[model samples]
Target: MHIQQLTIENFRNLATQTLNFHPQQNYISGCNGSGKTALLEALYSLGRGKSFRETQTRHIIAHQKDFYRLIAKIIDDKAEHLLGIERQTRDYRIRLDGENLSGLSALADLLPIQMLNSDHFALIDQGPEHRRRFTDYGLFYQDSRFLPAWQRYQYALKNRNAALRDNWPDEHIRPWHHQLSQTAQLIDQLRQIYLNDLEARLNYYHAELGGLETLNIRYHRGWAQDKTLEELLIQHLPRDRQLKHTRDGIHRAEWRIYAQEQDIAHYFSRGQQKTLLCALILAQNQVIQESSGKQPIILIDDITAELDPKRRELLLQFLTDSGAQLFITSIEALDTPKNRQHFFIQAGQLTPQS
Candidate 1:
């Protein structure tokens, strides 16, 4: 799937305008504070339902503007569809093909997007929550059963935690425990399958990117492997009561990356880490495409950060070959072939450059 055209209004500092896009590749260049990233943010919001840079609606809208709006013409499997979003301070509306959508999952399903930027390095450096979210994002696209099972699991976990906090009797909490155990097993199975695919693809891309070390990933299912979640919860009941929270469950599941059996952050340089993260994201995109036959849109903000010219060329080549629609931003125009469209932004205005 690819975006053919995008119209923006009152979004950040970008002027209201419609910009045409190349189905395969687009390079956006501009100086700092010139709204290059804002352009990418608009596209990301259309797909993901929120901005990566800012969370508050007030800040996302332009100064003195009441709301922000984005509309895009998307092509999926030879059919064109219209997707639009409008956000006000108190509410927001999403529409696809002229029909209103109550939620963003439809948008995500229609337009799968993978984003890479300096902030994404946190996927490696941050805690388990980020890693779990990373895995879940791919699963959301690959498996239809994932979301409903995940939702049920979250609901059970919430009730279980509440029961524990309230000092409920064992019998009262046991039902939630059963629900948690059943849903957790399913969630763990789905996550394991997805992560195994992710790991295999990640290593392939790592090698393709000239990585030498053996990269490995370890997934902890948040409970002892030898024991059922029900058994573990029973064993930890006292601790749960003392702590006023459920102590052991899938909520604590973690997945970590290792290089040569060492933590990646400790074993790899900054640039290597960034490259590995990019490879990981690309591998994820490949998995989604292979499983679902839908090519996701790839967005890379500040493609030059921490990457030398050689590495940048290598990454860009890989992306171009992936056959996904690409939107990349850089401070200066990259020296590449002229087949793709190029645009320069200044003071929130965009102009195509020949």
Candidate 2:
């Protein structure tokens, strides 16, 4: 999917404006605090329901403005869509093609976006939540059964946890256990399949992106392999009751990255870690494109930071070859042949240079 036009109003430092976009490449340039990243944040919010930079709506809205609004004209699979979002202090509204939508998933379905920035390094440096979320993002687009199974598992887990917390009888807790075990198995299977595909693509992109060491990913299913989820849950019931929550389940599942059998975080330098993260995201983009046959919009903030010229060029080339619409921000305009349009932003004003 590609955006044809974007309209912004009262969003951060960006002045109210409407700008056209190229289908393949768009380079946004400016000095610090020039609202370049805010432009990308506006677009990212349309795909994801919230901002990656700030979580609070009060801060996201322009100073003294009651709300912030974004509207995009998108082309996906040869059809045009009008997507709009309006965010207020405590509420938000979304509309697609003139129809009011209830949730953000609809927008995510239509506009699959992959974001790259300094904060994303957490995929390797942070805890299991980040890695699990990374895996689930792919699974959400790839597997039809993932969302429902995930919802069911969450529901069962909540009820099971409550039962333990409230000291419910074993019979009452057993039913939730059954539900949890069943859904857990399904989720575990789907995640494994998705990870297998991701690992293969990750290795391919890692090599193509000039990575040297042999990289591997190991999956932990949140329980001993020899025991079924049902067995594990049964065996851990007493401890779970004592702890007032189930600790050993799919919710605790994690995946780790390794370079030649050592953790990448320890083995790779800061730059190498960032490069590997880029490869991982690019691999995700490729997997989404191949499985869904819909190209996702790629957003990169501060594309030149930390990355050396050679790696940056390789990253840009790979993105260009993927045929996905790109929105990249830099302190100064990059000298590149693939850039089709350039926009300069300063102090809330945006001017198209080409």
Candidate 3:
């Protein structure tokens, strides 16, 4: 899906604005604090159903403004659709084609977006939560069974943890254990299959960046790989009660990346890490397109700041060939020639440049 127009008001320092956008590529350029990133965030909120940088709505609403509003006209193969959102301090209202939505997932169904910023390389350097989010976001778009299985697993885990904390007997917690094991097994199997599909794609893209093909990412099922999840969950029951938490399961699973048999982020340079993360994200993006036949709107914030000249060219070339609609922001305009809808952002204003 692609956004044809965006209307934003009371969002950060951005003034009231309604702007038309090209379907293929949109370039937003301005100096720092000129509302370049804010415009991107305005569009991002419509897709994600929340602000990209802030948890609370009040943090994103302009000073002295009670609320912020955004509207977007999106087009897909089926038809054109309208999505809108308005947020107060803690609550939000969302609409699709004039009808209200029950939750943000409904909006996400209309427009799936992927974003990358300066801190995006943290996907490798940070803790397991980052990798889990990366895995789930990609699977959420591709695997319909993923969400329900994840929900069931989470529910079972919560109840099971409660029993452990309360010192419940084995029989009392066995039922929840069974549920957790069943769901975790499904999650684990699906994740492995998903990664298997992505392995070749990851290698191909990483090699395209002129990096050596020494990438190896493996899914480590939190317990032992040899044993079944149900068997292992029961085996861990004794220690789990002592720890008062579910410690060994798919919930604790991790995706370990290795570069030339050495761990990622430890041996790789800053540019290499960014390139690796970009390949991984783009590989997942390719999986989404392969499964859904729709390329997600890609929000790239200040991409040139982090990469060297050759790596930057490689990344830009890869993005250009992806056929995905792009909304890229930068301090100064790059030398890209394929994009037609270019704008300069100065003090929250968008002036068309080409």
Candidate 4:
């Protein structure tokens, strides 16, 4: 779905603005700190349920405002859905179709989005948690049963850890362990199947985005491949008792990105790393589009950053042809074909460039 209207109030430095958006390519141009990124953050909030730049919703409020609110009217072929989000001091609420939502996935279901920002580089440099979340979100969207299985696994894992922490007997812990192992098998199987499909699609995108080295993604199922998770759980019971937490399961899932058979961070330059990450997100979007029949709104923050002139053209050329609504921010004005619309943001105000 494409955003038909965005209404923002008391969000960062952006003026109270309600603007209609193009269904295809849109460029928000401004110098650094001109509220371009803030608007993007507001849009991201409507879809993903939070700001990309800040962990705390309170931090997103304007200096003199007591709260922040954003509403987006999104439309596909059949109907239009209204997504409203409001953040108070310590709490936030999201509403869909005028009713409160219990799960943030509800918003994602309504308006799926993929974002590329500086912090996303952590998918390569950070530990397993970031990578797992990235992988899981993709799988969650593609496979209908992935979330239920994952939720059950997490529930069982939590109870098992609690039993271990409280020094409960094996009988108590083993039941939870058995429950976890069953779900773990399903989760791991789904992840492997997801990676298989994702890897195949990533190859085409990696090449299209100018990857020169041999790019590889290796999936580690968070346990010994030779044995089932049930066997590993039993074998590691003593260790799990000592540690008081799961050391083996789908929760420990991790995947590595390699270039020419070496860690990407070591073999790929910084600029190339950014491109590789963007390529992965775009490829994942393709998979999502195929599975859901709706391409997610693509948020390209500073789309030109660290990219050379030729690479910028290639990226924009690909996006222009992708048929997905694109919201991109840039420090300098960009010269694209006439189909693209431009907006200028300055001093917390957004105005059409005409």
Candidate 5:
């Protein structure tokens, strides 16, 4: 799917702006703090429920503004769709073509957008949570059912933790623990499948991205070494109650990125990590396009950061070959063919330049 156009109001530095986007490739050129990243953040919020840059909806609203709204025209092989999102002081609403889209998942089918940002390097340079979230989002893109199962697991986990905090008896939490385990088992199975697929795809794409080394992704479960999830939960009941929390479950799952049996988090250079992330994103887009018969919108923020000239062209070519619409942010003009399109963004305003 591709976004035909975007309308923004009171989002970030953008007071109000509308632009007809390129269905194939769009390059937004700007200097630092020119609202280039804000544009991508707005588009990403259409797919995801929150901004990739900020945690709260109120933070995205312009200063001195009470609310913000964004709408996009999405086009696919079947039909055109309108996705609208409005945020207020207390609540948020999403609509698709005049119909109320109560659940944020409704926005996912309207537009599948994949983003590559500087923070992505954290998957390799930081702790396990970042890598786990990256893997989970990738799995979410593939399997729709995983979301509800994940939601159920999170809800049960929260309740169990609250119960522990209240000094509830161990036996009183057994039922909730069992319920959490059931959904967590399903999540674990799906995550394993996705990790296997992701590992294979990453291997091939890593080499293609000029990283000749083999890349490995390991999913570590809290009870992986213990007995079945059922047995582990039963065994850990007392320990968890003493600790006053849900100690063992999918919430504790981790993902480790490695190269040649060595931890990449401590070993890989920043440039290598960025290249690996690029390959990972490109591979994910390719897989989605090949399987779903529809390509997702690709967003690459701060494209010139730590990327060599050769790798940049190669990455751009891969995006072009994917046949997916791309929104890339850069500081300078790219020496592409005359037919290529670009927009210059300055002081929160966007205008077509090439």
Candidate 6:
């Protein structure tokens, strides 16, 4: 699936715009704070049902505007449809081909786009939420059977957490805990398999990116590895009550990034971290291509943010060879002579440059 066109109104600094895009590759170039990132965020929101940059939908509207609208013309094998998402009176209306929809998962079925911004490195440096999103997105792209199971796990988790907050009796929470454990065990197993596969892919790309380092990706569950999720929750029931939250389970899991036994986040320089981020994203591209027949739309904002010339060239080459359609934002035209199509974003206006 690919987006042929995008129409935005009162979204961020963009007041009104309709821009056509290429199916294979698109380059958006502009200076800092020139709405380049906003364009990418708009595309991401259309596909993912929320802004990649912010959590609240209200923040996406222009400063003085009370509402915002985004529409994308998507092309798929069956037919072409207009996926429209609009916000009014603090509620979102999702429409496909002019028919109102109930949920955003329908949007997920139509498009699977991923964005790689500078903050994407947080998947390594920050909390489990980031790593969980990364792992779940990878799973979603690789395995079609994961979505429902994952959703059920989340539902059970929320209910359990609510029970803990409400100070419910242990017997009352026991059934939810059991159900959550069953779902979590399946998720945990699948996550381990995917991480193992991702580690291999990351190593291969890291070598190609000239890192030449042995990388180890480890998943840290909230409790001991040997303990079943149900056992962990039961053991921690008293502590969880004292803490007023769910203390141990899959929700607290984290992904540890390591380079040859050293934590990369603590030891690696900024440039090294950026390079690792690029390698991981490229590896994701490879995984999706190999595991599924679909090639995801990759949005790389500010392609040359902090890297030197050599690393930039290597990243650009890797992106070109990944066989995924890329939408890259750069300050100036890239030096690579790969017949790239460029679009210029200036003062909230976007126009094709090449």
lDDT of each: 0.88, 0.89, 0.83, 0.84, 0.82, 0.81
The 10-residue segment of model 3 with minimum total lDDT is: 331-340
Top lDDT: which candidate number?
A: 2
Clashes of each: 0, 0, 0, 0, 0, 0
Model 4 misplacement above 4 A: none
| Residue 161, model 1, lDDT | 85
Any residue pairs clashing in model 6, and if so which? none
Model 2 Cα lDDT, one tens digit per residue, 215-260? 8889998988998888888889999999999997889999988988
Every model: Cα RMSD to truth: 1.6, 1.6, 1.9, 1.7, 1.6, 2.0
Cα distance off (Å), candidate 2, residue 270: 1.4
lDDT of 6 by residue, 1-354 (tens): 678889999999874988887776788888888889998898888768888878877788888788899988988767899989988646889999989988877776667778888888788688789988888888887777678878887898788778888999989887887887887887777888889999998988888777967899988765678888889888888988887777766677788779868999897888788878888888887777677666677888887775677877887677666666678888987753556568888888898875
Ranking by lDDT: 2, 1, 4, 3, 5, 6
Query: TM-scores of all models?
Result: 0.95, 0.95, 0.93, 0.94, 0.95, 0.93
TM-score of 1: 0.95
Cα lDDT tens digits for candidate 5, 310-335:
88888888888878888888888665
The regions of model 6 sitting more than 4 angstroms off are 335-339
Worst 10 residues of 2 by lDDT: 332-341
Per-residue error for 137 in candidate 1, Å, reads 0.7
Cα-based RMSD of candidate 5: 1.6
Error of 5 at 106 (Å): 1.4
What's the lDDT of the predicted structure labeled candidate 4?
Answer: 0.84
Ranked by TM-score, the better of candidates 1 and 4 is 1
True lDDT of residue 66, candidate 6 = 88
